[model samples]
Target chain A: MPRLINRHPGRGPALMLGLVPFIVLIFAYLLGSHVRLAANPDDKLLPTPSTLMSTLHTYAAEEDVRSGQVLFWVDTMASLERILIALVLSASIGLAFGLAIGALPVVRAALAPFVAVVSMIPPLAILPILFIVLGLGEVAKIALMTLGIAPVIVRDLALRAAELPSEQLIKAQTLGASSWQLVTRVILPQMWPRLIDSLRLSMGCAWLFLIAAEAIASTEGLGYRIFLVRRYLAMDVILPYVAWITLLAFLMDWALKILRSRAFPWTDMSR
Target chain B: MARVTVKGLWKRYGDTVVLENINLDFADHEFVTIVGASGCGKTTFLRILLGMEQPSKGRLLIDGEPVSPEPGPDRGIVFQRYSLFPHLTVLGNLILGLELRRSRVLGKLFGARRREAIVRAESILEAVGLAGARDRYPAQLSGGMQQRLSIAQSVIGEPRILLLDEPFGALDPGITADMHKLILDLWAANAMTIFMVTHDLKEGFELGTRLLVFDKLRHDPQAPEAYGAKVTYDIPLRRLKNDRERQRLAIVEASGSEPSYAPAG
Candidate 1:
């Protein structure tokens, strides 16, 4: 009779429970850094919290030597721009292709196999090809990210569109919706939240591609900075940059979840 | 309001026949209820009437013109499920019909027309007893409420015909009874014709002005799919007063021609 173990924990307790793992991770990293740096002051593998803090301050606060801008803000902006552009392109393209594939048999038959083949070819493997074809610019980098994630998005959305109950389509038609109206109203509205969900899922892949592209060839970006300082084994910069990326990804995902719940509250119940 | 005429209709999928030799005339403002056993083509007939399905042979005419094969504003349908768009609220669902028909862009009703649509939708929602649940999503509603919302959504379009395919099949008896009253009231208020498919004999009898039974009169054990269901019995239930009288009409089996009707003695 221990109050049924409080099946639903209070909000404060739940928040604390979520933070426990992060706190443990931070403490473990701090302990490791302490033990390692105590023995070797110049150990580049696990930098001390002081070393990381100084690097963070420099990146975030100080101006760059050449550009007269904060390198951290510049890098963050560059990476974010690519990620956002690539996501918008993929989302629009994926939604269009997915809706076509789902609603039309001919489109599904013709494009499905091509999509499957493209999805199977790893996006990273074709990074050089993208650079070769599109050239080593923002276009190539964005293309790499889009290529990496769009096919999977298309495939997922197509499946979802196909799985949509025929009754809804029929009902819409009976309600005076033309084919175009049906697609825009009935199909598109239903897929909007799912598209956001697909994009949210693809964010991780988007980051991987962005980093890979930036690391290989870029003037300034989060990924480029991480790779740029890696020559001297700048673990302080590398670890914080990685953590920042993780934080950004988590925030984007959380925002999408909130948006989905607020905008399409019926989504969870129907599925 | 529309007159529906089915002439020498036959539906086949591959070699199997689903419905054959279906001929009937549905007058304007008629409350026609179709009842049959499972897979007996009652739903198919309703689908044909809604222009969702095509007969392999013959034709369906609405007001003397061949009804288009594609579903349109002329016919509105309510299925057992997926009747209302889950994403839209009850009020949104009700106004959607007018918005889609009137607005240049779908789901973007605005200005004076939007205000008019809202006013119209609210009145219909009130009529269907869903005034309080206007902003609630269809999923938030009970089965009965969802069906009511769906009916409101359909009727808001002012379609020539409203087709219901076992709309109350999922509801309990009390809710079903309430739905029956609501539907009849809607029918009384609107000028649109109604065609409802149901498995419940009592429901068909109680709600319908005219009753049509679909049954495979010529059963073949060797070639079960050879013969399809037809209009085995067509009864005018407006004259009948009691359950016993309706049951008497229900028992009359089909001859080759459409069954002749007489007032209950």
Candidate 2:
């Protein structure tokens, strides 16, 4: 008898309800594939589910005749290595620059405007310039990812440090904290959780930059593999590759989120 | 112990004057309570005493010497809120002062030194009745518990002077009485001069050995920034118990007829 808006489901029903859309989409895909396959057996636009699964298995398990390495994992490792290096580099640089810009007036006056200007420049537009200068090597790909996200992380952390309650700074000073001590003892520790949060938010952008760079120049990577097979209209290979990339991105984000909550429990007070 | 002396003190921010031509002397261990209307300079004056702000004119002397320009361990402060670090546990907050003082670069102690600091921190936590909550974060604690921790954080440093700016203003009325008792006990136990600013006049009368009232004795209707608040009433409460009622009545009358008291000059 309750109004639809007021009828809130319990946990089990809510979870089941959340899956309804995914279920509908999958059923629709299967129906479309069957219809397309019944008309023509050589249809490549919508591969049958069985064909898609076999293609995924081949790519994942079979060894390539030329490279002798499992192509899927080799591509995955190549992509992961580039993205992780860029992420680590971005995090460290962001923390240092952010704290410096936020805590000290001199540093802020000098660098805040510069950082703002840098962040405003669309990172993708500079990919050609990066490629020319750093060359079509691993450095260019890593640089692209770092450049795309580091400014954002720096700007976010700088604002966080700047908005720290003035009272806390004064209290720390009264406790005999020097200028350096203020940064390390008070400001630096609080930046860890926020840094992790910034990294989580930056993951998608990092992946985009990685893919774009790899598609343009790399010989071996997830993005390279997808583009390499696209000329033949290989939907089966491309579809599985896209799904694998999504799964990998989801897993990395999930791992970082779990690490943040576990290591910095105080940051999430709602729990 | 520290004896503080103020002479011809003035504070101004550009055209607006906050406090003007104030002077006073506080002996060691005196509990001075300051009361005034909003926008008055009680807080500014306290900041000057804490070395967080500089006087526009004249001097502030502690023990017959000019006070340090920068805040040091000699002075401790507790604001109304945001005084405790959110990232630190209750016990971590207590030993932070000692750690900063002893280990200049790292801001941390190690081995035997670390154990000693923890023991000291535990004793202070026990004193503040936060022993059970030593591992808890500030957000998890109630308002009263947080304020208690703030006070404990300030007192553990063994400062010569303690400045509190409306520390209990955000606490519930039921919890204030307990806070008052805790502060009074701390004041008695530590040989430190105390200055507290409060909006509640009766609280000023109850807790202080001396009461100071800051009110502007001059005003300009056209240019309101022409004048600033001064210490108009300095009542010695402890020595003159018989005169309490009379002084209270005088403050009420003065505040009631504030316009008459503020001359055009």
Candidate 3:
């Protein structure tokens, strides 16, 4: 662990750099809520950070909170679950597609036209069609999110794989690498950086869809929480959740970037 | 321990004849090198011997049997560019050929201990002077180190015919000399059959037991008296039999024509 740390001391600065956005977002949200609440001094029942924090403390103090609500933590949990599932789906699908496209030019040529056409459509534009077919449920959210983000994943992975030096494969073949051996041992590891970048982008896209999907169809999720609170003008409650979501996204992106540098120390060609 | 016979080998790129009637024979454990000016088809010859390229006409036989067009364990090849798998550590790339070639159905379930493979790989890495650098990925190594890795990776596999395509063509003189010594020592140690393609004539003379010079016949057509290229030069390892004979042969080789070629400094 110490040696690994020695290898990448830049991670400390990188993490700090990654934190800039989250800190700014949190500060802006808190400042906005304070000003809004200051102007609405008459409404004690309206959402504010202090009120929501106290309510949160009370809810924790009570041993039980209702499972469904516009502003409870359940939707946040579901959104997280949806994002996690989307990550796995996008990665596997993307990697497999990437390997195929990278190894064979025909596959890339055949799929490129469709990929360009698919990525151009907005994530929200397809949501209604998905809802019409799958109904306003988890299925619609997953389908929309997967369709919205899978192309980037595939594109990045395939591009990375394609750029791999042809000599590497020739070496592997001479080294007695079988078809499967070459893919797993050579092709897969080389494509990780792009895969990591794709994952980060996919997570952001998935999160984006989580909010929009809930806004349209679902009764639960962070998007619904924001919408429900806005009806009653609950800026305080929204700030903390927004802070949590922003902080989580920042952390995930940082963690992946760290992993990318650490895991692929050999790929310092751009260095 | 292997002999290669390339007979009337003809390779064409679409319609351009890259090699025509390339008849050559490499005796057992002989270090045979082919040198040619750019586009004279020296690399194509090496590839054909290694079974990386197929002759549009003619046959390449190892011992008495025709060689496969596809690369196989019987032949080993090192590219001019160090082509070791970047993701793998030095030892990983070295033993990859072994691992991929190891019997899998029952070998993994019931073969030699994993530690033995590691130990052997370490020794091979040491032989290649890459012992300390075994754990380092290929990308972390210098160009010279990567070249050494490529050699180690090929040598450990114990292939019958080791094919090299200008392995040190891009190296500085000092590094090239060191690699030349390292490779010669390894070749002597195993008495391995080596086929190297080079554009550097002196390096060819220093490293190979036989030199197959390409006869590239280019002429100023106005002078219709242009001669066919100097076709071949045998290394005359007559030097190995006795120092005096070796000197005599070197003098003869240095001054001869038709097949006589000068070594580049």
Docking class of 1: acceptable
DockQ-better candidate, 2 vs 3 = 2
Residue A188 alpha-carbon offset, candidate 2, angstroms:
1.2
Q: How does the DockQ of candidate 3 come out?
A: 0.35
Q: B132, model 1: CA deviation in Å?
A: 2.1
Query: Can you write out model 3's per-residue Cα lDDT over B1-265, one digit (the tens) per residue?
Result: 6877878777777745677676777789988877878776777777777666788888888888988778777777888784877767787787677777784332221246556777888887777777878787766676778888898888887888788888887776556656765787688787579989888887777667777788656555665333323355555553563564355457545654322112121
On lDDT, the leading prediction is 2
Order of the predicted models by TM-score, top scorer first: 2, 1, 3
Per-residue accuracy of model 1 over B178-219 as CA lDDT, tens digit each: 677678778888889999999999889888989999999998
User: Per-candidate DockQ versus the true complex?
Assistant: 0.40, 0.39, 0.35
TM-score of each: 0.89, 0.93, 0.79
Cα lDDT tens digits for candidate 3, A68-98: 3434456668888877787788788888988
State the local distance difference test value for candidate 3: 0.74
lDDT of 2 by residue, B140-232 (tens): 878788888999999989999999999999977765766776787799899999999999998898779999999999999999998999999
What TM-score does the A-chain of candidate 1 achieve? 0.93
